[model samples]
Target: MIETAILTPLEEELFALVNALEQFGFKKHKSLLGSLEIFEFHELNLLLALGGHGKTQFGVQSQYLLCQLPQVELLICAGAAGALSNELEIGDIVAATATVEHDYNLKFVNRPLPRFTGTPQVIDTLKQLPRTEWDFRLHFGLIASGDEDVVTVERGQELAYLTGCVAVAWEGVGGARSSQFAQKQYVELRGITDTANHCAAADFEVNLASAMFNLAKLIVRWQAAKDYCAV
Candidate 1:
């Protein structure tokens, strides 16, 4: 029986991970969405969706597709994010404690304050993983999500101050919202691919591969722990 679904924003983020899974007996199944990859691991069914970048695409795909996969007990959004905090370096991972839509607001009507928290049981499960011998550090904190790519030091600082988020991404908030609406346990794991600054693009291009691969490794380790099955 399939119980988990994973969503990634781009193929670059998931390609290496998908290839690695094939060695562990995960076979792909054809999916409705042209780029969607459905894999089976033992009795577990996993759906990997390519949501593209930005909140609109992510939210639409997540809500529409999750409804089709009613067997999913846990939904995870894993990908790369820009580091908003100076404490984070390239390849560091942050398991989002909560995701906030930093761009959501109604001028003169509402302020941008909506946040979606990770499911407590799932967060606990992630916390129990062995940390010894890990190459990069793992952090748990707020992740700010918005439509715009943060590429300036000033903007990054402003966002970090406003949301108190250590990382920023395009899809986390949207994915979290969709999972929440489906009443499914949700978690987001993001690897730092760049520091949000003038050099963000070059930094991301250089570090994205490692960051994504690390995320895949984390997911594999989490699955091996078998903690998610209890959720």
Candidate 2:
């Protein structure tokens, strides 16, 4: 049975992890979901799927993957995020214990914005991991998810204020939503590629490689340190 499924949002992001996983014998295969890229490693009964580029894309693909791969007990959302906190440096990771769907607000309709949280076991596992294995730092905080590009400091701060997030990304809420619906364990580990400032987009392009590599390296390190499938 496939015990874990890793859903990543971009081709570059997927390859960064796949390249890292190759040393452990993971290999590409014909995807059951034809539109998605799939990889498998038999010994661990692990699978990875390319979930496409945005929140909507990720939600649709992940929901389908969970339905088709019912044995998958854990879902991981991995990729890059813009830092909303001043302390975050490029290549740092925000292993969010909680996340907010900032764009899902309904204040006009008299409803509150939704927040997603939990996965304490996963947090504990990551916390107990050997720091020597990773070159980057880990920060546990709230991650804000929405469709906004968040290229300006003003906008980023606004999101940070509204959602109380340390990092902002396009796909975390969708990832969490899918896991919630599937009733599976979930966690999101995102690499900080750029600070959400005026130069955010340009900065993201410049730092993308290192951030993704570090993030992918962390995943491989985590897998080796703990048997996520067992508990």
Candidate 3:
């Protein structure tokens, strides 16, 4: 049974994690989820998949994979996110203790917002390590996801104030929703690629590499710690 799966939104991110996970002697595997790489560590098997770049792509892919592979208990959607918090610097990690679809509004229908919670088992697994083990600070807080690539300080502030998210990104909510529908555990881990501001695009390009590296490094290091594996 495939106990856990890691989904990334971009090719660069996919490869960065692949490189980091290679140390565990992973090998390519085929499935309805398309081409995937599998690695086993701490008695937990992690299959990595690329969901491409958006809520639609991520939702469709995650649901399809979970439907196809019912054994997968935890689905982790990890990638880059913009920092909405001034304290969060580039390259820091944000393990979403909760996720909210900030742009989703059903107020016209008197419906509540679509909000998702992360698996505490996964969060505790990440928190198991001491701060010194993490080269960068690891933040556990809310992450707001939407279809928009957040680029304005006003929009960033609005989302943070509304959803109580420290970081923002696209696609993670898709995974969160999909996992909720499938009745599976979910976790979203993001790296700060830029501050949600007018310069977001330029800053993302400049910091993406290190952000990805740090993300990959954190996952690998987490497994290496062998403190917990909730697959």
Candidate 4:
């Protein structure tokens, strides 16, 4: 009875995953968390919902819902991210070994809160997934999440230097905080869609749709594993 919680921050990603879940024949029980609608797949008690950009309020609401579930053991925050390093290509997945709030700093004050960072626990469930199931390559590194998007090269490098994080995204921190505080195992799956270069790269347009689609497929695989073990 291992319940899993899947959260996406964007509507398009949520819709894609919901539709794909239906194709897998799972009926979603609907509910609302403030203004956000959450769909729970009944058989596995897995929760699905969106946490809009830097929407810490919505993320907190969603986590409260997950807390109500008796068996939720894992929390997955999956979505698109912009790459900061040259080695990463579009559509590749970066599974975070650790995560931090890169935007938090103490330059204006004596010191910031001590809770801004940590060594995230490794995701054992993701590790159990057979490597041949998907065509995506997975990298383990520090994922920097914050309220702002890393749209500029200078900002990206600065944040990376400040946090010693390899990549940055807009929503992972809020989602990560709630999940970790709730005592659930957490893992972030970021599909790289844009480079830190800022300028629209020709490859970005070609890769984004596929990255979104593939992310859905990966979620389905995760759902299947949880669904299988429950039986």
lDDT of each: 0.81, 0.82, 0.81, 0.69
Taking the tens digit of each residue's C-alpha lDDT, what string does model 4 give over 128-170?
A: 7666967776667778877775667898788777776667776
Clashes of 1: 1
Candidates ranked, most accurate by TM-score first: 2, 1, 3, 4
Steric clash pairs (candidate 4): none
Identify the runs in model 2 with alpha carbons over 4 angstroms from their true place.
23-32, 43-45, 109-111, 228-231
How do the residues 56-128 of candidate 3 rate in per-residue lDDT, one tens digit apiece? 8999888888887899999999888999999899999999998888888775586656778898877987888
Residue 146, model 1: lDDT of 89
How would you encode candidate 1's per-residue C-alpha lDDT over 176-206 as one tens digit per residue? 8889889988888999999998888898889
Would you give me the overall lDDT of model 1?
0.81
Give the clash count for each candidate.
Answer: 1, 0, 0, 0
Candidate with maximal lDDT = 2
Better of 2 and 3 by lDDT: 2
Preferred candidate (TM-score higher): 1 or 4: 1
Question: Could you tell me the TM-score of candidate 4?
Answer: 0.78
In the order shown, the candidates' Cα RMSDs to the true structure are 2.4, 2.2, 2.9, 3.6
